[model samples]
Target: MTETSPASALLEVTDLAVGFRTMDGQVQAVRNAGFSLGAGQTLAIVGESGSGKSTTAMAVIGLLPGNGKVTAGSIRFDGQELVGLAESKMRAIRGRSIGLVPQDPMSNLNPVTKIGTQVAETLLVHGMATSKDVDRKVVEVLTAAGLPDAAERAKQYPHEFSGGMRQRALIAIGLACRPRLLIADEPTSALDVTVQRTILDQIGRMTDELGTSVLLITHDLGLAAERAAELVVMHRGEVVETGPARQLLEDPQHPYTQSLVRAAPSVAAVRLSPGAFAAPASQRLHLAETEPGSGGAGPGGSAVAVATAAGPDGVPPEPAEQNYAKTPNIVELKDLSKVYRIRGKAGDFHAVRNVSLEIPRGRTVAIVGESGSGKTTTARMLLKLITPTSGSITFDGVDVASLEKKALRSFRQRVQPIFQDPYSSLDPMFTIERILEEPLKTYKRGDRAERAARVRELMEQVALPASMLRRYPAELSGGQRQRVAIARALALNPELIVCDEPVSALDVLVQAQILKLLGDLQRDLGLSYLFISHDLAVVRLISDYVCVMKDGELVEAATSEEVFQNPRHPYTRKLLASIPGNELNIDGELAS
Candidate 1:
């Protein structure tokens, strides 16, 4: 990496300030934030969700929303001032001189247009290719961006491609003109670890080949520390610290930066002692007593016991020979599979194939895999959202497929879902209070007065202020919205909750907060969670046992400690290896 200096820097921002015109008044989004990126160097701005990282990047790229403006500062790219550059002039520099890979590929790529056309548009817009040769150029860029079958992939719409593929398409467009600078804003935030690594690797290779300076904006501290040569820590609207990536991460000077390192799952997991979930024997919840004549295992080898905890005196508890087999499973999937029939020549898509797992009562069992690995399909089957093809889902010793209308309704009350995107899962048209109360009303659990009181109680349970109950989902932040989603899931007093990528959309700090909240809730309510996620770092923190899936097959199942410390399967090891900054040697707790 080239050392950056004021004179030699390819992109330099000094004393940058950005503001947005809101209903209240001008609100400062970025304040005096400054950073410099040398040619062929990568610099990252890391912070929580509301921090000014994205705003600063948008300001530099001349892509701020209509309501936003660069109030003050100088953005000098390739020795030219850009803060007050004309719109026409900025347009010329945007695609031709400075490329941008936006955060969300689904929203960035036009759904109706073919991927090839999108790439071709950028090449044509920048005069990089003509109408006759644009198609070939499109294929060339997509292939360079690491898309397999580039020619066929180019003919598909945005919706047809997977998340990683769409991101590659965006990369193809971003680097089509081989710009001197690239701005990647949370480019891999929504992708799984393996795919995230692949995308970042591809970016590194492409940028290196073109000698492009990159300015990356992300909330992932570990990823920033691993991928960037220099790091800029942002807090609120200001840059708090800047230094070499390794030096800054190993010894973060700013309190906020320190907290971020501590809160990061990959780093924090190191501080968690083995058997972190183990509680005192007295506090452990025994969901069921040992059954007579039934040695230890439940039907079909489903039941498993919670990890034995230490006694009150800090002595390890004695192991019961038949304890695990005697325990009752809260939920079980036996040879469960789902097959979807395709309309085209493609016959049937086997989404889940004979996947079997058990979620013990009052414990979290996470199902983890890359996208299309059948993790989500297994979750949906457990929730009874879709009919299984040849297997059974047993909930509380009863087959879910055998549940009648009344029993199904009762089952619904005991098993609730917390979806991935809290903003989309919540009802935007309704207030928080109504969102929580609607479930109660549907089940006719209580009177209006009783329901109103329950709503407040649920809010307090999730550590949210009661004052926000009247506000709609639009009025709340991402974490706040997730809290509301959790509150609604708990309003019914469910014994089991299926959390599908609950904290994947949240930042490191908020992800830690939400995970802590879920842990506390489980301990207090004795709830069971069938957590589904693609993030192994997060799964290590919350899950008691983990089931690894790949291509609709269960590859490995073991305790969290076994999965993380001594993964037996090659696929599981690969997933662990893909985690960013997993090799860091940080010690001691940094989170509050």
Candidate 2:
């Protein structure tokens, strides 16, 4: 990578270290991490879940909670050491000299407040402008970030905006003061593929136009390779490799990087035949095995790799890259709808309208929508988590909503639900070993010894260590806890798993790893997943079929490529257009 412009270097992180003191052990989340970004430059810190990318970003902003501490480091923003600065003093620098685009908008944004007020508050805090001026600046920032009708939008609360727009609002606040440096931690993790692309591209362009430097923390190597000029690869809180993005992706120096690229799954070999979606999961898993030159890590952390010995799709190949590695009918909905009645003085509310669709087995179908858009409600109906108000919810030809308690529990074994937050899904009081084994015990599938063995196998399947089994959920990072959650979901060996925004909380790199794992599992075990997420980009990468929802209604559903390349639904199109990555114009918005 070229040198950060000596005079233009806006933020420099030198010899940074971060750790967490817990009862079980002291986890070194980051150690001796260093990087520099000049005006208009974007630097991406890429790594798997435990690599400490998020920890480093948190340290830069003095935001580590609990027992986590910045053991040693210098976060130099415009040559000012921010590590030891007082809260009030540091507060001045933040949003003015340095800004933050938080990972989770839900947590970062106040639910009850208007979006405009939040953005205005930032300006007010820095005393950059008067109330009137803050309002005008808020509108300008929102417009630049590509939100629709900035004036009207600013008045709406966080709950009103779509997932993509909410992200843009966060950026607006971060850039409200035109800070010299922007720290974005997994900014695109929860967005759809199209949205993910748009968000990054927008950031890329905005940084250039504003001459703002950026420190991007993500796990998505593909994204890092595409957007970042320089790449820093970390593993276990240590920097193992740092270099140009293209070089690292094309010819990674570290074994971990190399293995990650190999283990990733691709969309090129998606079932093209009439019976493609109907093929046994085993056959689909082995579909591309015999045809490839060299085998990489197979899906779901399973060791099996199969190929057909065919050429590369009879087309000139781009390159052998991307490490690692969905459907229509099993979960079908006809006139599916959900509504809730207000018990107080108010009346009934229609949360979900009439929706209809057929989900094929062995294919992934994503239900994307804003919060309260009936996406979660739909998932509940499918998994029988919550009975639909008035719709025929069929799973494997059975009307699940009509089932009794015992039968419903039995049906749950066939279709399990994976939650969005790793923090809440796991029982903090329960050991990881116990957490994983609970599902198996609930089902009484086998002997205690056999169940214990299954837990171990599952731990290996999710790429988690057996030793982690002794630890509690609080003892693990966001990614590890999520992995354990997946293992728990897999214990029943269900025919279908309802994954609800599973990777939204993880860093991009860890998100990719989880996506790769899900793909691997589908191939190895031929498991059918009913994946639900707001992230269209991940949906694009992993799903066979796409289902877009808005306000509890179906917007669109089609193949991955078809939907991404040409989205007919206006809402879906808006989501695609708002992605930050696609908004990137490498003309040096900052350099100019």
Candidate 3:
């Protein structure tokens, strides 16, 4: 096992500052930041959106963008100065000694390349093995990641794997030759709770077994608490505080850390000291359990039920027929399904199967499922993004499919969709001012002066700086960009916003801010939402109703309180079991 060398640190970054030249002005993207890592150690840098955590990591890897440059800093890796290392020299050590597992493996991986070939390239490039050894090494590394049918899966491309599996495949590539350090950024943000545990557990176990120092950069404090030994808090391009994970989280010396830890809304209270709140085993389990029948509990009170398909004449039907509800329904569907046709070879694939559900307005609904399970598809149909293959979506006493092109625009204006990656949603060429004004312009909501004034009002509404009006999307942090996205969604004063994993990309504290922002908005505006996400903890906090989806089918839809407390569907039970908490314990379906 690799051990920390007292002679010198494995990776040391000192006095780092990064800046970028923008049309408006020179923005200080990253301020003075410093940290170090040793073998078998895990350090997590936590902060809200716009903090310099990601910038620091990129500087260390020499991956800074074109306009951004390190003003002052030094990076020493294993006694070798890396600040000015040649690309060729750095490339040799990048994966061999300092590996990187990116934020979105789906985007990072080559879509057309086979998984085994991708795994073997790392070894071949580093000169660790020959072409003949690729197949065996691929199987070995993939199996180590707990992937089933390793040999067969190895031959598939990245598109063939689920979000969690793709994450493991990337980890397998990172660990192919066992680098001294591994950088994983928001590794599990995109996966469901059940699959989330498997990925986190695998990464933790591998990092421990290989003695590879891990730098886990993320916004989720719970994830850090689960895997990291040490924590560093950064804000506005500076290191605010640093200490052991338990110490910094429990009794955080910095106000920022305290605010972040409090933001989760998980009802977890943090005490300021080591081993602060030690609950008995029974208490832990009880806290995980919430008030029962959580229907219509989200944002407004989410709606959930495990009712199956209904037969003709309002009679109770098969599992694939209908999901009945005792109360009046806000949103109802019958046999909703979506299918996508492959370009040339394999025919069509059922992206979402027959789904039937009923959700009350002013209630939050969570659709849970693995990747490609049609969670997003359901959200899209609700938003009228694409015409459903064969189903009806009735909203506010009107059939959505009945609308024409001109009418669809009006529907889009009312039912806005907030995406997962806030940065991509906004245009890079436009300033925040222009970005917000375009929608108002398209809809002709207000005059120029009214639009400009509304833009400033929106910035403050989402808790952003007034100075951010002229700034571009790239200038803002992930959290800030999300706030901007929210502002855009509200430009028309939308009634029901289709939030598609809006908070998944942000840090825990920023997540709290966004949730509070949404909740406050709903209370004040009386807005309804169809929230689609995989984070159960966040779902519990914001949703009143829950809808669980699988293989394109609605497995369970019920109140958040009921679904979390007394889940009837087997899939719902599995999802609750996967959350990263000690309170509620449900055994995973995977055989022990």
Candidate 4:
């Protein structure tokens, strides 16, 4: 563990313990966790959900929920004891001395108020500015946080701003008073890579100018290693390891820390294969005509196809004249577009424009871009959820727009969707058994006994226990819930699955499990996928081919290896450069 002298430490936490009062009883959240940050230094606490990292940060900022409190330990800020500080005195220090940038900007910022009013409130409360000059100060703060046209933007409400713009507004409020310390909790978890990098860069510049220390809370190991100087690994309510960022991540001693490093796709030198984890050999799938030396070895010492290589002339080699190229196309989008006409807006808004792509049999093709880039719009059109303003969609040699009621019913049964939020995707009122059995009953596939047997088989396929069938969705963890979602998608044994940001909401370990499961299923059953996501690292891990989208246009489309190693488009290159920890070399290979 890295140590900081008390004299030089800006925030020192020792033997800290926190608990929340629940209806059943008092539940401990953080226990015996300790770390110290020197003045102007940055520290990060990283762990999965319910790991107490965020709880620790809340305790330090004296903003724990009404039911939560610090049960034991010491909190000293600049040599002043804060553990037992009075509420009035703590309020005085909360925003003026210690600032906060919360995780979800939409939930944290008031929806009804204008952006300028929210920012001005912070300055006025801290006595940073007077009424006559408060609006100017708000513009200056927003400008410093990298918001363009700050004066004009300040007149808008939170809902009117984009995700990145809202986050910048939060930062402007947090640093309006130039606090001595700042606490940022998963500030960019929901943002695209390029925007995440821009936000972090702005934070670095502002903090350096003000000489402010930072306490960052996040679940992304690559992000933590890139932004912070020191690392603190948190497990179930305890500190497992702490050290210098690069040293700790490269040579993690704790088993938990090592698992995190292995699960992180951003830092892995090679793509994770089915054999990389503990899966039965009978479950592994192999592709035909896989070239020699084109794949990576898994933990079981078996080669798995990861990426297709280019030829000697920097062009992708043509497929050999074989049955592999003869495989039929599963889904095709030809010049598809969607234009929404607003009630007041004069011009029509094109969400997706002239997007054409093909999903081959038993292969994964991914659509990747930032928010409002029309990736989701494309997926929705392919699903037949929305009618395209122009162009055509063909499914298995039949045009989708020509399908009637019965034909559409058959089409829905042949194709399935795995949505992003597991919590909302599954019905909370239904048991796991019922959730899995509903589709079987809908199709009249078999009797009650047969449906029961199929439900059990699905649970086994997703690696969930049959005992969980009796439980509700609320009883399962995030990973378990996602496994249930995947099982539901496979219930009908569809030929193609549309996974929309399936693993983006999950942590590294759980995300690895989901990706491995998807790969295994694709191999076991000749399933095709139309995957949509904003994470290029995840796209690298799971996709066979990649389509880069921007402002509703297809910027670049190529094999996964070609897109990452030889990006031809400027936007594609920018996205690659934005991935955190891309500069670090791990195990003799670049992290990106």
lDDT of 4: 0.81
Write the residue-wise lDDT of candidate 3 on 1-592 in tens digits. 2323545577787788888888887888777787778867888887876788887887777788888888877888888888878989988788888888777776788999998889888878887778887778789888876677799888888987866688778878877778888887777777777666876787677678887888888887767766788888998889999887766666777777767766654522211111112222211110011124442322222223433322336554433422223324556665677888854437886776666666555545567676666888888888877778887787777788898888878887878888888867899999999988989999897888998899888888888888988899987877888999999999988778889889887777778678878877876776677788888777766765667877677666655655766787787788767666434111111111
Stretches off by above 4 angstroms in model 3 are 1-5, 12-36, 66-74, 105-120, 133-172, 267-328, 342-348, 446-460, 465-467, 581-592
Residue-level lDDT of model 4, residues 1-592, one tens digit each, is 3578888899999999999999889999999999999888889999887889999999998989999999999999989999989989999999999999997687789999999999999999999999999999999999988777799889989987766678888888888888899899987776678878877887787668878888999877778888999999999999999999988887789999888877777523333322133222112121221233332111111122323344457564455512223456788777678998854448997887767667778878888888678888899888999999998899999999999999998998889999877887899999999999999999897999999999999999999999999999988988899999999999998999999989876778888899889989987887888888877778877776677888777766665655777787799999998989765432322343
- Better lDDT candidate (2, 3): 3
* Candidate 4 wrongly placed segments (more than 4 Å): 22-25, 105-177, 267-310, 313-325, 342-346, 428-430, 441-448, 583-592
Give one digit per residue, the lDDT tens place, for model 2 in 59-121: 888788879988887888777888878999987776777789987787789999999899888
Worst 10 residues of 2 by lDDT: 295-304
Clash numbers, per candidate: 3, 61, 43, 0
- Please name the candidate that would achieve the greatest TM-score relative to the true structure: 1
TM-score of 4: 0.84
Question: Of 3 and 4, which scores higher on TM-score?
Answer: 4
Per-residue error (Å), model 4, residue 118: 4.7
lDDT of each: 0.81, 0.71, 0.72, 0.81
lDDT of 1 by residue, 41-83 (tens): 8999998888988889889889999999999989999899998
Please provide TM-scores, in order, for all candidate models, with all chains considered together: 0.89, 0.74, 0.79, 0.84
The parts of candidate 2 lying over 4 Å away from their true place are 18-29, 64-73, 86-88, 110-117, 129-169, 260-329, 338-354, 366-377, 385-391, 437-466, 504-526, 533-544, 548-592
- Looking at model 1, which ten-residue stretch has the lowest summed lDDT? 287-296
The candidate 3 region of ten consecutive residues with least summed lDDT is 281-290
Candidate 3 Cα lDDT to native:
0.72
